[model samples]
Target chain A: MEGFETIIFEKKGQLALITLNRPRVLNIYNVRMRDELYEVLSAIESDSDVHVAIIRGAGEKAFCAGADLSEFLSAPAPTFARHVRWHRDVWGLFLNLPQPVIGALHGYVFGSGIEMAMCCDIRIASEDAVFGLPEVALGFIPAAGATQTVPRAVGPGHALDLLLTGRRVGAQEALAMRLVNRVVPRNDLQVEAEKLAEKIAGYDQGAVRKLKQAVSRGLDLPVGSHP
Target chain B: MNSIVKLECDRGLAVIRLEQDPPGPGLADRLAAICDELNYNTDIRAAVITGSGPVFCGDAATAHGAQAAFSLSTPVASLNCPVIAAINGDAIGIGLELALACDIRIAAGMAHFSLPEIEGGLIPFDGATQRLPRLVGRARAIELMLTGEVITADEALRIGLVSRVVPAEDVLNVALEMGREMAGKASWALRYCKEAVYKGLDRTLAQGLQLEGDLYFLLHTTEDRVEGVKSFKEKRKPEFKGK
Candidate 1:
């Protein structure tokens, strides 16, 4: 937590909250945010006192807009960029976190925003929230885990529709598609997210973590093989 | 040669109707035979399957039950062409199994669905135990099977069990309407799409994506694919001959 700047990490009881602190830019994911998130998530992974973690954005506008084009578009070279990406493994860290991560999303959730939200074990979206993956339109694909995780949550058809068309989806439609666990009124987003985090924290952490492992691993197995 | 399972093929759409007044033990065999006919009938592009009676199967004659049901449903799962189940009434036990085997299901407004085998101390011997979870997820699947509840058409639609719902009288006609429309597409692409989805379910995301890319590439080599591209350029509907 000492090196954190782009994000805020705080522990209240057993719940650890990670808030994207870049409200000025709508929390656009940039080089700095990526580096800070990697460090923060690593600390959360090792912190046994944190039974559950919540990721949200500061202010009312966005969970995250997308990548900071100013930084990404001017990156060194393709080969060096690949190495930079390989060194972090931020998305893998998000997925491998032992504690269940809940995403409290609102406003703009696009491209890397949606990808980040997809990594969370449970997602609660505000009614005003919008989701999309605009990478395909930008002549690139979602290099993040969106390609895989989106399909796992919403099935191939819906995932393909969103990825190929790059269309925006509202909170209600996202809920219907199983993209988010549920949708709440914009005003009630924080309350709903906190209540859920507290409830999950109240449960036996051992059983909860084990159950998450069973499901995450079980889905990868062939149909009849799950024991 | 069984009268209970009637097969009628016209144009590119095939309709299979199960018409056992009180479905006999041979229903399973007849269903298997119907699966074989559809598989061999290369001209057929899409299929509509419905049961003719007050109930789809008042109760499917579960002859040897588990093993028999598993063998019977295997062909449906692997059908090269898409099959749409026009569920007209209550689908319980093995009857529900038959509908679950189809690619899409359109249930009648009055229809009810259940897997009451648990009430009899038997689990779903068919693929329901597996397919249900894939369709609706594990928690709901467990609740449905464990509690053995009968859900209405609306409830089924809400849970993704059936894709659509129509009046009881229109179940067959609606299914035929949809079948004909889908049958009119590029047959090669239709078959490949279904294949990728059904097979993809068994593979990892990376593997599934690879399989999809392979099948998509294979489609480009087909005559129908060429015609499809040509038709789009010429602003006319492509007449696909399944080549």
Candidate 2:
């Protein structure tokens, strides 16, 4: 919380809010941000008082426009890159969090931004939000769970449409595809996300966690094998 | 002409029509046997399962029949070729279960889908409890099964239950068109792709990718694949011999 340079973590009642704090660069996910997020998420996972969490950006322009290419594009030795990635499985930590994570999306959510949002259990986007997965156009594929998660969320046809074409999707269009749970005015984005988090937090924690686990685990079973 | 189902195979496309008005008590076993026949029938490339009359299929004769329906439904999923369900009208109870067993479902605009087994103090025995959630999401599946809610074709499409909803008269035609299109593709690739996708569902991403990569390499070694590339270069349609 204190040493982090790229994110601000705050606890409010039973809800924890983690804001992507690099507003000047549109909250681009730099290496520092990754390290900081891993630390914060670890803390949140261990915190017994936190029943739910909301992830959003600090500025109005974007919610983490993706990786900081300046630092990431400069080739690190393959071994060093692997070592860094091994040390910081931030996305894995995001997915494994026990409490449901709600993504409050706004402005530009592209590439890694969309990948991160896909990790959340529910997503609420502002009407001004623009979403895209431009990795294909950038001569690479989304290394994050976008390959699997996008298809799971919006079916294969639509997932392929977005993945292959790299087209930008508006908030309304995203809602129609069931990519986001709800879309709201830009002004109400934070409050709406907060309200949902609090509402979920009010539920029986035991029942809520069990239900989440059941669906998450049960979905992996083959059709006839479901008990 | 069969008492249980009518099967017609033409140009690699097989049409399986439920002959009984209500898909009667013994329909489950008969349909399962038909599936067994189609599974190894190398001549059949794709299949469409549609009823003869207005209603695709009605409620089963007894609770025992419903149980048999569940036990026998797995064969449809096991077929080597793709199976499409052309739902012409109300698909309820066992009728809906039969449709759910198919790989793809095309519903008529007037068709209604429901899993009403719960109302009779029973769960959907024929894979609906499992497959419905897998097709749609957990929330919608739970709501439908728990409430016994009957949804329209449009609603079914919105929820991802059915791939497409066409007019009542066009349901069979649409399904046949899709069947023919799938039949025209390289048969080896079609079967291999289906195998990969279906089998991959039960695997983790890493494992699934490995399987897909293996299948891709295997396809490159097939004669059909060579013909495909050759045809592309020659600017002509490739004649696939299902090798």
Candidate 3:
């Protein structure tokens, strides 16, 4: 109903635009962002009018640099924190969205950022976008869905390389890894992401949802279980 | 400890070499012991298994009566930390199975790979039957086995059997460097990442997601995780205690 401190949620003509609003810190994912995203994603999932969603960041510097490490490590109580994490379940929310999601990515997309982008059905990265999963360098694995989502996106070889070495890749390299579906000029990222979102939003909602389910659920089935 | 298997430990890395030219009997026990050593030696965060001379582990890997005991895959795959197979030469038959059990592989340019156990009227007794198909897909894995085709290092790389292919001399160094890089990071996280991939891949999608989520939550309880965050905030390299 009102504004969120960490995200901008707007809907127009069956399309939802969810912007990561903490531009001051390159939209590093924080607890507030997690809560706001849970709400936004939940809203999009339930609302029949919202046909598709476009997620982007509000800054020139980054789509999302990574998770806010300070907030992530400081916990009230182990049990409570773990419970809260499961309750928010931001990555699960992203993956389970009924409407197809598009990631309009730019700048530093690292760690949780990479995981988030991979959750999207489609991703369009700006030329200036730089991607990485530097969790290994910091002494932790990517606690987000990266270990699973990334391999699904880039295959195990490239995924293992990026995860193990904590190396950063440019937008071109990310595209080559198939991490992002399309690359565009920095200025054109929003336009392109919106164009794709608009096109999907215009399609017959039932058919569009079925197509997403067919492709994603089809991948999950065991080899012989289908054919 | 034995002449058949030479092990060297240094700053968070265990380098195990197959020194036995014609790998003698009891090689499996020696390897299994090394795996146990790697598991208990908290100091050693990663390992590289390579051949000392030309061949990685020459023949006799799954040789009839001793085949069950000689499976190279079980011990290597059981290691807690990330394992890199520095395939210095031909990794044929069960040797290739050894390489497949590793989490990553850096092969020598002169190296060759094949699953020619069929010629001996035997199917690969080690983890090859399952691991090969997973790595290169069922079709290619079958093709390689059915044809008994020996693929070059470049071909192995193309098929995703090995991650990198370097000159014969550089293979060990490359694999060692990769192992060292992984060792320097938070060791438990490395284990967690490996577990998520290896364990999650086999389950149904929902089960895989659940497993990944479980591991992700479990990391929050580690001190290294807190240190990782604090150091990031401080703008200094995190001192991972796991090392």
Candidate 4:
């Protein structure tokens, strides 16, 4: 966890706190972040001590603006890229983390950022947050399973609107659309998310997992991850 | 232009206007032809399907509810570019279905929408039954279909039925600006993105990943794939050949 460059992983009591740490560039997801996330998520999934997790960004400017398309789409070869995606499948791991994951969102949540936030069971956004899926407008499809997850979370109309037109919705609009569970002041976002995570951690862990399975699995799940 | 459907193209953007209410007897074939041209013309990257003088499209109250609906949906659903449904007026019956088929929908603030077939003792034969639920949700789709209530544009936007609500005079321009923005992207990538997302919706997780990966691999064989990467490295726009 200490060696990971893109994320900060820490365990406090029964709560696991994961922060997207690349603040200089607004925590944009990159290949390094992908590999690090894979390692951290695999660990979180297997750790029974962690009853709940909170994911937030390190800086005030953004939760995560987007992804480093230049890095990802520039894989040296298709063969190598395909095999890595198949074997690692970070998006799949993130989607199915057994523990309830709370997203403490702020600033720009676009492309993979919005997709990642959607994976969390409950999203708490700061008033300054903005959500979008501009990948198509940028001349690439979001490969992080947002095509499926977004419709499942906010329904198809909102999903396609964001996906096709690249429209950016503010946190209040996101709240109206039920994309996020709640919107708070920027300073309270992290604490609110963590408090919810603690409340869930206080509950019986097995029951929480069963509850998640009962609802989410019933609604279908990420196209990148197995049920 | 044909009797009802009119086509206009400008630098990779195509605008198809339904010039008559209930379109025309030839609308099914007309839309099919438009879709065919959209598919074959690699230069065309985006489209706007709107109606003339206050209606996006109107349905002919006939026995061909299911058949007509299918005819309207299949062509638009199978397009090679992203399409915007610029609803300037009431989009009712098959009209609503046509709007539902497009990837993105924009409506004038005063426009109305409904899938009122259920009120007429029939179900939505076109793509509404499927696409509506897919767009909104199962419960909302059912409620809208069962009530057969016409909703205003703002209400439609509230429920995710339409993404944008604008003044009537600005609807077409707003849609065209959006279309032109998307139209600037690599044409082949646009089609491929549509394919992956649309078909991926129906495929299993493993199969969806396979389709995505396979498509990524397939692109390696194309010259545009090389050009895409090169352009990025060169810090300039890619000159996609649509090859």
Give me the runs in candidate 3 sitting further than 4 Å from their true place. A182-188, A225-227, B21-25, B57-69, B117-122
- Indicate the residue-level lDDT of B202 in model 1: 74
Off by over 4 Å in 1: A1-151, A154-174, A179-218, A221-227, B21-25, B61-71
| Tens digit of per-residue lDDT, candidate 4, span B196-226 | 6677667654455567566656666666666
Task: Name the best candidate (by TM-score).
Answer: 4
Which prediction has the highest lDDT against the true structure? 3
Residue pairs that clash (backbone atoms under 3 angstroms), model 2: none
| CA RMSD per model (angstroms) | 8.1, 8.9, 3.1, 3.6
Q: Report the C-alpha lDDT of model 1 over B157-232, residue by residue, as the tens digit.
A: 7877786789999998988987887677666566655666557677774455455555654554556655655564
User: TM-score of model 4, chain A?
Assistant: 0.94
CAPRI tier of model 2? incorrect
lDDT of 3 by residue, A50-104 (tens): 9999999898899999988777655676568667767777777788888999999
**TM-score of the first chain of model 1:** 0.96
Ranking by lDDT: 3, 4, 1, 2
The local lDDT score (0 to 100) that residue B181 gets in candidate 3 is 79
Candidate order by decreasing TM-score: 4, 3, 1, 2
* Local error of candidate 1 at residue B89 (angstroms): 0.7
Model 3, C-alpha of A48: deviation from truth (Å): 2.3
